[model samples]
Target: MDERVEAVLRDGRAPGFHGLVVMRGGEVVLERYGAGPDHRLGEPLGHVTFGRDTLHDLRSVSKSVVALLYGIALGDGLVPEPGAGLTAQFPEYRDLAEDPGKAHLTIEHALTMTLGLDWNEDAPYTSPANSEIAMELAPDRYRYVLERPVAEEAGKRWRYCGGATALLGGIIARGTGRPVEEYAAEALFGPLGITDFAWTKGGDGVASAAAGLRLRPVDLAAVGQLVLDGGRGIVP
Candidate 1:
């Protein structure tokens, strides 16, 4: 290990940092874990001792996995072209179809986070005002996302909208006739030999495409390796 890297890890350990993995040339060059008590909102839940088999929450990292699955869906012809209008796929959302701005939204917009919906995630996760929290609490998660007031024309600007990812998950479920997690297992994870993992779902029973996935760090590193391999044989 490089001295500078060692110094940084030493510093990170004091602040509840858990694990770090570094890969190069499709190989793990460094892997380390630190000891600390894992807590939720300042409440000490229990001590965490990380290891090779530890399943860590991927959080927003799941978004990347969702993106990969979308690619697979595209290859399998399960979804329409990127230019396809979002409203066309979910005609049941009659209210959204009437809104010209949202009606014009595209799969490209959702994938790029350019839906231009007014979303505020700057607040802490515990805050009800957080767009993500609000979406999670809504009765109809898809409707909650689709009904968000348009802040700008679709694809005109960038905004971090967890709702958009939720919509994408719904689209995946609709297109493939399977839950996002199931689709991923057959399409991506199975090929990658990633068998042990967890994907959380929203109230709608669809996987949370925005931020809910858990995997061992070693398996997560395999995802990186897959990318470095130019996505060879991972899809199709």
Candidate 2:
């Protein structure tokens, strides 16, 4: 609608930028889409001419959505509270839970990404060296995360760890007796009228709660609107 928007549409700025949707007082103010290359998970999808119907990967934005879903599931009493012991929720990892060093770890620590675990995402996502990619390649993602050497005391500091989101997704699935995507559909997306979306999963079929969500620009805007609306329709 303006020179800046026109420049973005031409890909002269933010080359891979796909779309934008702005709303004010729950009313659409401006909306735009553009042509760009896209990928599913990490696989190339070629160039795409995006529009209202086309789904765009949210990447790390998926983490925020997972957090919202966690809150919703918690409100339904389907997941553990923040104060609950982290490893205690995964009884299969008995030895890890028994570790006195990790005894201070709680769900709150994971929620806030303050578990102080030894994690590394400094590598490119395509590299196996990345902690997230390594988690996906592991036999058990939860154990891969929970077994990481403690870098510091839990809740002592905040750190960026996709493993934390994966653990939260596991907890939600374990408690709701359903996958994160399935629970999201029933509890969040459906209420928000987001019908067309894709959640990429790992080789083990678990959704990449860290960075796998895809939604159209308009629908993604609706999600932002929900947060602005104090989560009135879905989250508690």
Candidate 3:
């Protein structure tokens, strides 16, 4: 372990973090645990006890990973082109087509968060403008995102479209013949030796691609190396 990291661990303590694994250059350079895996569980768990092997939620960072996977799917012919009609892919959203403007929306717009919809990602729960809250209330998640009013033309601007990420997840699910999490495992994670991981699905069963991934520190190190190596394929 580097002196700096050790210093941080000694000074700042994390609760419920019973294990930690630190690595550099794709190697396990440091690891600490309260005790055996069993001992660490069922207790508050100590600082530095959780690490490379222990799962840590990456939160919204999952969105980036999902986007990367989406690209892979696109390259592998597992996903439709950006110009494809989202409504055409999932006919279930046929009702959205009732609005002439809604049919014009495309996957590309959602990818860039340029859906032009009236949405406030972090609006108060009481506010109808909250994109997430509006999604919940809508009859369908995809339509909820697509039907959002056109603040501008598709891809005319960029916004933090978390809703678009989730909607893309759903679209990928349909194209790949599996859930995003599972597709990731089969297409990405498993090949990289990351077998134990969980993806929290939203109310709609989409993998919340906007942000929802957990990983172990060792696995984290492996991924770090992968990126540093110029996006070398994972699990290959």
lDDT tens per residue, model 1, 126-182: 777999988888998878878888788778788888887888888888899999999
Which is better, 1 or 3, measured by lDDT?
A: 1
**Candidate 1: which pairs clash?**
none
1 or 2, which is superior by lDDT?
A: 2
Highest-scoring model, lDDT: 2
How many Å off is the CA of 200 in candidate 2? 0.3
Worst 10 residues of 1 by lDDT: 36-45
Model 1, position 153, has a per-residue lDDT of 76
Give the least accurate 10-residue stretch of model 3, judged by summed lDDT.
35-44
Question: What is candidate 2's lDDT per residue for 84-170, written digit by digit as tens?
Answer: 999999999999999999988988998999999999999999998999999999989999999999999788888899999999999
In model 2, which residue pairs have backbone atoms overlapping below 3 Å? none
Q: Is 1 or 3 the stronger prediction by TM-score? A: 1
CA-lDDT, candidates in order: 0.81, 0.91, 0.68
Task: Indicate whether candidate 2 or candidate 3 has the larger lDDT.
Answer: 2
